[model samples]
Target: MIQVHAWADLDYDVLVRDMRAVAFDLDNTLASSKQPMSAAMTDRFAELTHRTTVAVITGGRYELVVSQVLDAIGGRADRSRMHLMPTGGSRYYRWHVDDDGCGRWKCVYAHDLSETDRRAAAASVETRARELGLWETRVWGERIEDRGSQLTFSALGQQAPETAKRSWDPDDKKKRMLVAAVSRDLPHLKVRSGGYTSIDISLPGMDKSFAVHELARVLGVEVGGIVFVGDRMNPGGNDYPAAEAGAYAVRVGSPDDTLRFLERLLVRL
Candidate 1:
């Protein structure tokens, strides 16, 4: 079993103060899966940007992050200090403020797959899931989304309710099976389980590990100088890559835990 630690288990003051950046996994870490971030969480996140550089790295698309996170925090944050790494870090966006102080997001880099690759990936995921008897007849929204830098396969559909998604595959068995099959078919691509009942396929080097290292390079901090917080940090979980890349890892069970973590971090920062 993965060892679990409480907030008090670490020397949080020293850890928080020494860190140059704090990176987070969005879905379950910041909000309920595919749900909007709560007002309380938004306030704490906005407050965090002022004290330290913040990076949101997730398997979600940029637009999803915008609606669920950025828009919710709207105008209350130091956008310049915030970095958005989405599509499992295959793409990156940073804030740009215009003369009138109207801030907008600007893409820094995107490792989008070619049209041919995208088609192949989508085909492989669908074919394998069906072969494995994992495809759902009823879904909430688009099951396959062509995110620029990655392709996501939401088993229950993108708009599935949180309760249903949570109950679908609590231990990630189904997703892991799907990931393994898709990975074999698309050997050159990176395939991993994402969110509650989803799979993410991207370029080999594009993942949360890439996000961590890239952020460290851009922010001029050593790998150890960044901390990564997430809900899923187990071996094959999407958030595992950040921990593998050497970011100090903090795990939270829900957004409430994330809020409490932010509260403690703000006190130290």
Candidate 2:
């Protein structure tokens, strides 16, 4: 088993120098929950891409990645050096740079769930959450979403503010109950905790583990040469799968911590 290291404890110079790629979790790692990258983060991330291959693997859809990350960095960054694996690596997008310097994203692969699987996951998620009294009475936006390759259940609704999301189930108790119940009903599907208060349902083996290998394969690097950084590396956290996949995983406290690490890595690279 791989040991998760605290951001402060890592040898940034050695790690950054040897790593072929750096992958990040979107929410709480690269940006605030459901929010765009901050100005500092955008600049640093754009710069980092120019130095080494980068990727953002999230439970969010392609649209969210574009809105929350790519849009913020714009053409300033080297998109060709980056990969976007949305929906927990169920879908992968690569960038194609044009002769005029404009870049376009291409969907190289997608593992979208079938309609039957989507229906089953959505039903199981809602039914189990309600049965366990974990479903909220009121929500900010959507409680359940069909994200093409994944079905997500957000406890406090998809549009819940960052503050509310942070406070909803800090202990992960509520999400644990919901995830367990849903998983039992959908034995063939993969269900894991996502973002701040969301549960992601995807095809079996289609988690961050899949993302790690996919990134390495696409980048033509060994799995050990990739460094995945995220806020969640605990057993049930979505980021755990990356560690399980044999990548050097470092756990950070928040996006600020992630930014600081990126700065150190940039200096080393």
Candidate 3:
């Protein structure tokens, strides 16, 4: 018999009564950059949803983010209670499409920085950077992800190699260094690291944390009614949004760790 960790065998009557919903940050929370959640996680999530709503919020693009849902939670009927908020809290969609195939989808804020501006900004930033010799551009498909906002710098014109782009700073440490360096140069913009390899800049107050708060209004639950789990909870990271919303923040170890975390949460609730 598989020896389930003590985490798998917990009592949940305490921490759950007030929890109207449970939100998770994708990537490291639900699935690691390398693997998806194990069966243990999906089953645990299924178990948890029997008591409270579950939502997933991530900085990953929408198309890619939903696939994670399909993987860990394919056919659970309570899926209607599951929510998927993607793009750094820039988008929201509830689980379960209605008869016509639509439940709830909201795109709060987005921007398109095309190649001209990308070139202009990159030229400005890179040229100044050259003068300072502080930074270099890792061109990815004419799309200058000035952080993660997806600037159409090259009009999505010529593409850059995904392998090369991802390798630019796989751990995101280099990207963090780049954010600090560029923000020092462009102080007016809010520059921060997101996902695994991207740096994003936005106007102040343009972030997912606030987005979660905004999205909470739709759930009709106080921000405090939600418990958010995520791996990245640093000051300017993507997961910071959920942590900031007055929600209970549960930090876990890996992509699959969330499953066990949920199981513990369910039993303890």
On TM-score, the candidate that comes out on top is 2
Per-residue lDDT tens digits for candidate 3, residues 1-269, read 11112223333554477667878777667765524555766677666667777777766656556556555666653776767666565555665455897654444445434445444556544444345433445443434434334321221122334345445555656655666776676565556676554555555554567656865787887887777777766555567766666766666655556666665566566
Candidate 2 per-residue lDDT over residues 100-168, each given as its tens digit: 977689998999899999999989988998898878887899899999899999988988998898888
What's each prediction's clash count?
Answer: 0, 0, 24
Model 1 Cα lDDT, one tens digit per residue, 143-230: 9999978999999999998889889999999998999999999999988888889999889888888999999999988988888899
**Model 2 off-target regions past 4 Å?**
98-102
Q: Where does candidate 1 clash, by residue pair?
A: none
The model with the greatest lDDT is: 2
List the RMSD of every prediction in angstroms.
Answer: 1.9, 1.4, 7.0
List the global CA lDDT of all models: 0.88, 0.90, 0.58
Runs off by more than 4 Å, candidate 3: 1-13, 96-173, 184-189, 202-204
Clashing pairs in 2: none
Give model 2 RMSD, 1 decimal: 1.4
TM-score of 2: 0.96
